[model samples]
Target chain A: MAKGGVAAERRRPHSHLREATVGYAFILPALVGIVALYLFPLIKTAYLSFTKTGVFGDSTFIGGANYANLVTDPTFGTALRSSAIYTVIVLLAIPISIVIAALIAQVRHGATLYRIAYFLPVVTLPVAVGMVWRFIYNGDFGLLNALLSLIGIDGKAWVADPTVAIFAVSAVGIWTSLGTAIIILGAGLQGIPQDLYEAASLDGAGPLRQFRSITLPLLTPSIFFVSVLSVIGSLQMFDLIYVMIGRNNPALSQSQTIVYLFYQKAFVEGNRGYGAAIAIALLLIIMALTAIQFRLQKRWVFYG
Target chain B: MGNTQPRHHQIIIHAVLGIGAVIMVAPFIWQILTTFKTVTESRAVPPTILPAVWSIAAYERFFTSVPLWSLLGMSLGVLVVRVGGQLVLCSLAAYGFARFRFPGRGLLFGVFLVMLMAPSQLFLISQFDLMKSLHLLDTLPAIAIPGMFSAFGTFLMRQAFIAIPKEFEEAARLDGANSWQLFWRILLPMTGPTLAALGVLTSLYSWNDLLWPLIVASNKHMTLPVGLSLLQGQYGTDYPTLMAGSLIASLPLIIVFVILQRQFFAGIASSGLKG
Candidate 1:
């Protein structure tokens, strides 16, 4: 590129070449860092998944063994199920946030106050959020139990129960994500035409009818975007579970997401090759899901 | 547009928003209340919303035990340095892409866009290796250096700059203003909202960041998030202390959001939609 730019400048003697060369020079550092650090590792992960590396460095060729094991691994099956559940649950919350955004958009009084309250969790550091929420879920004196006790309800160890742990974690995911979803949905709602509502009313459509006919169709693009992002993010869920549920937590074995399993194999266990396989598998899942969403968007997402 | 139906709709609107507000504010209220309670008080059978005896014991203990001040300093230090560098460099690159007709421009900017799609997890190992090789393993710069350039910021800024009327830049060019002067005098001033949104977003990310700082800063440069995590470990099962630390760590973000709430949403929506 530098050669091409310099060569073109010599022939044409144009100011555009000088300007472009300078632009490239300024962007060079970030480009170099990203290529070396991000893209290289991504490619390397893909390559390493194909080979058999005993340690992080020592290597041998054993094509498809790790991936074949990944196919039948019971843990992988469980993790996949858990990841799917988390994604579905989190995706469900998007509509709830959209409804909330719609309601907030209609109200003139203290709308910013509602936004701030919701966004507080979004802005809080994930580590801190994890810690605080972990304490709230504690079995004995945890706030959830205490709150339940008020109504004579027994709140078991929410995050320790295998049946409920993933859901518990999903609840936090829903909470933290509410702010971004609300803000995005609110922006989408504002893009909707005011005349649509007025016209619907003149035609004798009720409020709910107006929203169903007017708002829902127009908001589909943002809704689709939020769903796509939520799925991608939920599949990669790790930080909160890692922090809230201890490494030794019994629920960890039952509720592990694929990315959490990948972190375990790659970072903690130092089975870098197997971990790389899991990472690559997870990448394939993301790519497939994203491709499908883009394909399906034609059926649903409205541009306006 | 008549008053009756519009007024009736207003009642439903408030009721709905009111419920949403309660749900959103509940957990934070719980967190704040827990911070003030004693370990025993927090664990009481009928969980107390407000402490029976109000005390600063938890807050006092957190400050004394953890290097809360140093962690705060680290968060601020990384935020100030990285945000300053990123604002300058990202805006420059954004303007270059938006205005200048340069050779290989499409290919160069394509790299930035591609990098935007790549998640931070992909770079964890290589970035660690880079920092280790540079002998910056346990330093603040390890975190700040990677954060100094953001693809999203550059992409958003370029869009903002492109939205500026080309005639403004052309007028500056007609007056013999150089490229730098055009960017500084004409372009920068015109994109105030974009810059505000970028600044707030960048600062918030840097301030609340955990993953990279966790990987990069060994012990010496422990930021607030990392420090708070360690606090959770050390004070095993101590809710009050953890709550207090979490509260303190959250204060900066809350203050920043309150002051710049409008810009934060604007920035997030624009960047999310575009990127």
Candidate 2:
């Protein structure tokens, strides 16, 4: 291309030829990295899902056996259900975070402090975060039970009980993600012109009316961004659950996500082909959900 | 909207925010206090907020049981390389996308955006296989190589470069500066905030990453989070010792966050807005 560009430049006297050569050179590293790591692996995963992998990682074409097994597997059903429940439940963080962002934006003092405090969870290692929360949820001598006792209420083992374990973990999800949602929404809030609010006030709009009319509409873009990311992150949830609910936990079967199942099948059981199929399933799910969100965005995501 | 609230409203806001702040920070405080307690004290009913007799036994046990310093060294090594690679590669790619008019530019950029949207788990099996084929499994490079380049980083840097006026580049070109010269001397220096933000984000991700490292390394090569996970599995109910290990593992990143809080927040906010 550079050689052709040099030859063309002599006849056309165009600077674009030189710039294009430089541009290609500049992007070469990134292009190579992306293709080698991302694109190839993506295609390879898709291909591997159709085969059976041996103990030594040698694969043979198995047709639809893996997918057939995935559909019939009870564990896969539980993982899918848990993933859906976890994703839906964790989205509660969005509205709560929006309220926090609004409150922080309204206050004249200590905004930075609030942001720092809330963001602490986001920056901490998930393993560490899970461990700390696990200690707090311990049934025998947990902080949650102690706190409940102070209010004259009984608290069962939060993460040990399958019925409440997913919800308990989802609550931690909300706590950890609240900081990020707030920061994004806070930036969105700042983007809204104050004159709009002042104008609304002159026409007798109260805080609630002003918020409903102006803030919610203008903030929809950030809200959409946060919600989409939250959903994706929740669907792929593994680190927190793996650490908080151990392999022996009674709730493990009920609360394990698709990724956790993938890890178990691929690494623990050495079923690489089956794991690849699960990963592809997750990828397709993510794409479909993301596509649906994009399709629905036009209805509610206010561009202006 | 700043300082426009009535006095009574201000009080209400402060009260609500204060309570929220306490809830947010309570875990870290609990972890620290737990680190100093005895195992028996940690398991005491009504779980004492402060130990009756503070002890250093947990810390001693943690250090002796785990290769703490080596794990930290491994994590830091990965972080430095990952951050440095992303800074250079992402900036170069972003500059190319922002400044040049080339065939397939739109197509390549679209590819980057799609890559960003796809979950990292999609690449897990193949990435592991790649590492295995290259004989790089259970090594630091296996852990760091895949993370060294990021679609999100490229997109971010491209946006930052695009935000810069074209006039500067045109002026530099007229002054006989080449593309590399202009990028190095003019545009790069001016992108201090953007670079800092990227650096903070890349470092945070590399330091806190668990899954990739867990899959790629074991024992001696393990990074902090992976090593800490092993510690949890081995020590099961030793809450005090586990908390000690957790606190020690998290301290460096917390310190980095404290020092670069503004850049961290700005990076996350901008990514959300532009993404």
Model 1 chain A poorest ten-residue lDDT run: A25-34
Give a tens-digit lDDT track for model 1, residues B110-159.
87776676555655555666787899987888888888777888888898
Give the worst 10-residue stretch by lDDT in candidate 2 chain B.
B266-275
Model 2 chain A: weakest 10-residue lDDT segment is A8-17
Model 2, span A1-304: residue lDDT tens: 9999878768663667777889998898998999899988888888889999954878899998999999999999999998998899889989989888999998777888889998899888889999999999988899989999999989989999999888889889989889889988999999999999988888888888988999999999999999998888899999888999989999999999999999899877888889989999998999999889999999999998
Looking at model 1 chain B, report the run of 10 residues with the lowest lDDT sum: B1-10
Each candidate's fnat, listed in order, reads: 0.51, 0.73
Q: In candidate 1, what are the lDDT values of residues A1-304, reduced to their tens digit?
A: 9999888778775656677776776666666655676677777777778777654377777799889999999999999998998888888779889888888877767888888988888788888788888888888878788778889999989998888899898889998888888898888888888888888888998878977989899999989888887887788777787778767789988899987787677666767778788888887788899889999999999886
Residue pairs clashing in model 1 are none
Q: What TM-score, over all chains together, does every model reach? A: 0.92, 0.96
- Per-model clash counts, in order, read 0, 0
Against the reference, the lDDT scores of all candidates come to 0.81, 0.89
